[model samples]
Target chain A: EPEVTQTPSHQVTQMGQEVILRCVPISNHLYFYWYRQILGQKVEFLVSFYNNEISEKSEIFDDQFSVERPDGSNFTLKIRSTKLEDSAMYFCASSDQYNQPQHFGDGTRLSIL
Target chain B: EDKVVQSPLSLVVHEGDTVTLNCSYEVTNFRSLLWYKQEKKAPTFLFMLTSSGIEKKSGRLSSILDKKELFSILNITATQTGDSAVYLCAVYISSGSARQLTFGSGTQLTVLP
Candidate 1:
């Protein structure tokens, strides 16, 4: 059972610093996604990537956020300037095809100071 | 805005008891509904229901979707301490843009011995 893997299980950074969350989605999957959850809130979709471009993004995914598949295996989310409200558990997910069940990673807990 | 609502924010039950969690959603171009189990940081896929009436089951857990009514239910029978976790329901919808997920707040279930 191959699963998505995320690096730096916990990240702590200054409010104005930049942060990058890394994920290695399942090798054969084509669609990748990023989602976040505030401490007590529902999981919110931020962005989705396919064919080497952003397929969709939410309003929360503003200019501060960017995603890339820098390599064949790594998918990363970079925040140019972190904010206190950006502190949350960021999750990476992938699916084999359209409408397929998306598998998720353990998540990286981002904490802004 | 697409929304997913889950009922009963929290629940507690004893061993061998049965419990059911409910999820309702209002989204355009509904594609599929998914159930996930979140024990701590990461969420694991449980079931994906694409059609109405047909049930998707794994062990003591089963889920069914009602597309006509715009709701879904997850049932866990003979609950154990291991079943104590937050259950999340997310709807996958693609109206005009790319597909994305809309998650409910989730139901926290605690099973005691």
Candidate 2:
């Protein structure tokens, strides 16, 4: 059972600093996504990526957020400047096709100070 | 705007008891509904349904989708302490723009001995 994997299970950064969350989706997956969950809130979609470009993004994924597939196996989400409200559990997920079910990673807990 | 809602924010049950979790969604271009189990770490995939009136089952857990009503249900029978976790229901919106998933707040299930 191959699964998505993320690095830095927990990240702590100062406000106004830049942060990058990394994920390695399933090797064969084509569609990748990023989602976040504030403590006690529902999971919210951030962005979706396919064919080496961003397919869609939410309002939360504003000017501060950017995603890139820097390599064949790594998908990275970079936040230009962090804020207290940005603290949440960031999850990476991938699916084989457009309408298929996605497999998720363990998530990286981002904490802004 | 797409939305997913799960009833009963939290539940408590004893071993051997049966429980049913409900999920409702309102989304454009609904493609599939999925269920996931989350403990302390990542969420594990459980089931996915694309058609209405068809049931998908795995072990003691089973799920059915009702496209007409725009809702789904997950049932777990003969529960054990191991079943204690947060159950999440998500809906896939399949459009050319990007594939996004809307997730509910999730139901927290606690099974006691």
Worst 10 residues of 1 chain A by lDDT: A95-104
> Model 1, A48-97: lDDT tens per residue?
99999999999999999999999999999999999999999999999999
Candidate 2: residue A32 lDDT (0-100): 97
Tens digits of lDDT, candidate 2, A1-113 = 89999988999999999999999999999999999999999889999999999998889999999999999999999999999999999999999987788899999999999
Q: For each candidate, what is the lDDT?
A: 0.95, 0.94
After superposition, which runs of candidate 1 have C-alpha atoms over 4 Å from their true positions? none
TM-score of chain B of each: 0.96, 0.97
Candidate 2 — which residues are off by over 4 angstroms? Answer: none
